[model samples]
Target: MKLLLAGIVLILIIMWKPMPSGAGDMWRAYSDMREANWKNSDKYFHARGNSDAASRGAGGRWAAEVISNAREWVQERTGHGAEDSAADQKANEHGRNGGDPNDYRLLGLPEKY
Candidate 1:
């Protein structure tokens, strides 16, 4: 009877043990902040206009790279890369054309974009 009671206690302890936290719930947030810094750095450079088209293009390219990294982070966390790509494409297109006239559609873009 004592053995049976001990076995039950062990089983309860095993069941109650905590599961390990996922990396998506932790490290990915730091990765995202790094990526944002890269993109914002590009915008800051472009605003200055100290360089010609080629250098500005390079900055834009870096921004694209940071965006890609952010997308990968999102994919790892949610398993939904296609959705992020579609949303990103829409945002880029809007920026290229100087944004939508309608305020509702314009809600998604950041104030500077």
Candidate 2:
């Protein structure tokens, strides 16, 4: 099946390019978001995490894609709204495509972020 093939390919990619710094990039983004806890900033953090990881190179990009997609998939199954998940996915893709994470940054978010 196509889905099975895709899953196998995905597994191979993960094995081939286990992210090093990219994982840390994603983690730092998450930690920053939690520390900031600024209002209306979820999307920004999502973008930031993806962007930071993606900037690391191909492996990082793949890791970001896997992580983001997995997160969204989990969220959608756990009572999260489809619309919000879609928006989050859009932000993830935007960052993966090299869009500035700051574009999603809040107007007055703490400079520490």
- Model 2 segments more than 4 A misplaced: 1-18
Model 1 lDDT tens row, 1-113 = 99999998886554333211112222332343344454323322222111111122333333433444465567658876676556544543343333432322222334442
Model 2 residue 47 lDDT score? 93
Q: Which stretches of candidate 1 lie over 4 Å from their true place?
A: 1-56, 69-73, 96-113
Model 2: per-residue Cα lDDT over 1-113, one tens digit each: 99999998987776456477777788888899999989889899999999988987788888899989999999999999999999999999989899999999999999899
Q: Pick the candidate with the highest lDDT.
A: 2
Task: Work out how many backbone clashes candidate 2 has.
Answer: 0
Which one wins on TM-score?
2
Candidate 2 lands at a TM-score of: 0.83
Task: Determine which window of 10 residues in candidate 1 has minimal summed lDDT.
Answer: 45-54
